[model samples]
Target: MEFSLLGPVGVATGAGELVLGPAKRRSVLALLLLQPNITVTIEQFMSSLWEDEPPAHARTVVQGHVSRLRQMLAEGGAEAYGVELVTRGSSYLLRLPEELIDAHRFSGLMALARPESAPQDAVSLLREALGLWRGPALSGTVSGAQFAAAAHALEERRLAAVGALATAHGALGEHDHAAAILYAEAAANPLREGLVAALMQALYRGGRQSDAINWFHRTRQLLGEELGVDPGERLTRAYEEILRAEAVATQPPARTQPPARQQPSGPVDPRVQPAPERAQQPSIPRQQGHAPAAQGRSPGSGTTGGPGGTDSTVDTGSTGGTRGTGSTGGAPDRSTAPRFLPRPPARFLGRETQLAELTRWLTDTGSGESPIAVVTGPAGVGKTACAVQWSHRYASAFPDGQLFADLGGFGEGAEATPTAVLREFLLGLGTPPEQIPPSADAASALYRSLVARRRVLVVLDNARSSAQVRPLLPGGPGCATIVTSRSRLDGLVVTDVARPVPVQVLGTDEGVALLGTMLGHDRVAEEPDAARALVALCEGLPLALRAAAAQLTARPRWRLARLAAALGDERRRLSLLSAEDTGIAAALRNSVARLSADDARLLSQLAMGTGREVDALAMAALAGSDPERARDGLDRLAEMHLVDEAATDRYVISTLVQLFARDKEAGEGGSPPASTER
Candidate 1:
């Protein structure tokens, strides 16, 4: 069986090419086959299929396509070649030999066709590699940005192969063949500096120095007009080498470029929150308890924001699940002062200390500056619930309107830009839509001007970065802003003096009590030991405990031990979390998804280890890089809440997060960075 992404995405088995049906079905297959034996989440499919907002039921559509593809692959006897597509949790995995993928095969051939290889052998490998392309990859098939980026990355490698091939031809003393190859490729892609450099060298080697020089001048003129720059180093280096009449080597001389960012395909990883080791820490808190939502002023009808704020369009949905008595996304009515504090959490857990701290700091009145409080934690860690719960408790202090914006920093959806958020806040403050300025700076200035003396409460939830929350900070005395985010938003702390309250998973006792509250006291009484076991399984995360409770409540026949037993295995824990709709797995994915390609790769490597705590040395061993890189990666992972710093150099992975990481590693198909690293 062969899966091809080199040209049109296709599957060819011993039965011959199988019909992939629609373009999207092929796209689904193409994306899955992009990394064979790896799981592609439905969210990733939606991301690859549509660049903008996907239609409702996009998940169902993707499932239908996957179902049909499965039937076709089964009927085509793909299993005969050890290939099969299967679903795991919220993701799909395709198991097959990597050699069966044309893209993978192409890469392998390129690696072997190095410029350092013997010219004859290199030529053979290059021709075979180049021959695999029937046309441009994913030809005639439209896809979203991720696919486009992947295709662009693939095309780059193909060109690199072409350059290596041309150099081989030159080594074989077939300058005309080399020049011909470079000429045709360069003609089509006149802007690629590498291709131009190779073409120039090929012409020079063929005793056509004047021809090469002329080509350089032409390219130089084209670059100046089109790109507003002269030739880059590669083109210039080849030109100078030709001018000096010096002999050149098989490979072109140019500065090595950095690798491109790797595109991670899955649910975004959760934002990481730091915590002391369980024993070292005295307490940790989770959020619960839904308070009455403070109402917004009457909304003005038919108001929409300016173009610059489109992505930041405000949804008037109460963050606390309370419905505001108004239409969504309208200007606030000036008749009554609005109370905008989001309703507090519905299921309040522990976090008394943090709440009191917020109350003391922000309510001081004599602090001289508006107090900004940030509640930081990983996704599913209940940061938002804690922040809002506290906000509702102190609602009487800020009689002015309360403002809330869910800056989608850590989730599958687009991260909210500051400009978009400002528009919504401005409108919420009763500024007419037409009066709203188009630029972020202008809008921010107007908003600050209008809010100068108001004692408003601003709750910015799910913020991606500190920069996103800065402009939304209102000015005035008696005003306070509370932000909930995965990152610590250190910049806000440093520059804006935002107070940070880090939310960790609930402590053991609080987690068990919360679980009992969800499942009922009788259930806990009946399975006393089992209840404790379940809490340990949940690892003090309220979201996980709530999910486990909900799962048990829905199926009363299932004992707590049964659920506990199910979650005992690390590998299946995340899958179980998904099954229970616990949100931990998705949160983990969201956090992981935020990492840079290199950092994500390092995470997968680190997850391949055996022990729970891995210091920089162990991480370095797994990273197969320097200690500095491993330390940096560990710190980065910890900041994202993917890993936790247990000590100065030691990092720890939660049971659920570790499972998700292993799943990602398995999907990408690699062994642990090293078996001995841990």
Candidate 2:
């Protein structure tokens, strides 16, 4: 019997939703559902139920609640439901298959709704699984620790469901549908620009090009009014593209001209208009309307005119034209969308060509090519921010919405397994936990199918390898994806794998501009010699520059001259580059801390290796291990961004990074640097 804890408490057997007891009893059942297959002692239950205190007969009262829950489960007449809520020495144990609990079920289905599945199947499965929610998981209960955990799990599932649906619509080339979903969600959750951007993409692709153009304006207005800032550079660029009418060609209405279908029983609101053609005057020249043959759809599914064709205003949650109550036109109205994680900060300095190239690839300059781009860089060269900013810029192209996840290429713990990343991606898409499939492969299939033709942007940041990103690719064409990694994901058989853009440190001009932005341009210009010295010390690394800027921001009295002097000493440079959560030193340490013991040792040894390019054989010799061990260490270091893989079997470290590592070694009072054939 399958169970679902994703919605208002209900246990589904083959029969139907088994009614639990009263609110108290339902609460108890919900708690049990959260920890299925685990024993919850009476004391723990009571404390969770009533944190401060409980009645003298709390134990008996708990028993009564349990009894009621049992009867409710049995009411559905399913043997599995009636089977057991057993007594294990002084505690009650709930035993059921992982699939029988709603929360668990949601997780399973989310896994199933990945990028690789057939589009129709993934959409149907994701929507069905997400529909289980009546409201928040165990709504109406004052959450304690157990409820909190369950709620987080359920919310994650919800996001996964949305992500799956958004992706599916994109894959199927249904940008209008995707935009509607994304707009609704973004309005509900304004803090999540990723969703807003996704909706913007859908709008652009759905022929609602005007709506997409206006969205960034609304976003900027919202961010300024609510968040006290301008829309970031990425969002700004997307807006500029729409205004300029240079957006990619939208998925056409249909090919083969399917028979018109009966309309649903709703009046066409007068406010909506047919989506406009892309490229207004002065933009790129317009092209003749050409429709790609539809895939996967059976011959009979009818093509009705979209709402854009109707005069009715499409009320998919977001307000248009007139400013409604809580509208983005006035303030930063939160869209009714699930929040994906925020993009990495723009600590990155330069590389405009890389950004333009990425944008060009995604939009393809009216060329009818599939959209996929990969970003490659040496360690600490700022690939993640490039991907993040690029997504921010072309967000409108994918209007169904945006999805982002770190593949944990160099993060703490295990390199993020594809399955784990897919699980998170599904949640971001809005899959309920109970709906995620059982296996990673199944989840990957589902993920691909979901994004077959939607204009959603999936940013797989900090990936380790192609295997890490392969299962994550959406099957159909409408969706676009950007992956950032140290390794070159060449030779991977996927469509539109653009040439890897090698992210290097900022050039002198870009580095200086970056510093000017952080520290005052006036101050830096006043001391040109000192400014050049500071940039040199930072080695034009964006992270290091930001860290330096942050430090200077904190200490107004310290001059750039003093700061330059501190950086001149290798012993103090690492300290100068340290910031709490964001800094060159801290980021590197995080990468180091996450490594396996073997990997960590290898990194430390490799750090001391000197060369413009450190090869595997020399690295292996330094590690006192064989070629394989050395290669593994090199790979680990590359993933961590401490050392970069420059080319086949050649590794290099940034000037700042090498100095930082050297400083760290000196602080530890190491004898000498590891030897290398110069």
Top model by lDDT, which number? 1
**Candidate 2 deviant stretches above 4 angstroms:** 1-349, 365-370, 413-424, 427-433, 490-498, 593-652, 660-678
lDDT of 1 by residue, 22-41 (tens): 88888898888777787899
TM-score of 1: 0.52
Give candidate 1 misplaced runs (Cα > 4 Å). Answer: 1-335, 580-582, 670-678
Model 2 C-alpha lDDT per residue in residues 315-380, reported as the tens digit of each score: 111122211121111221224222232433434456789988887677763654456678876556
Ten-residue segment with the worst summed lDDT in candidate 1?
283-292
Q: In model 1, how large is the Cα lDDT of residue 585? A: 81
> What do the candidate models score in CA lDDT, each in turn?
0.69, 0.60
TM-scores for every predicted model: 0.52, 0.46
lDDT measured at residue 282 in model 2 versus the true structure, 0 to 100: 26
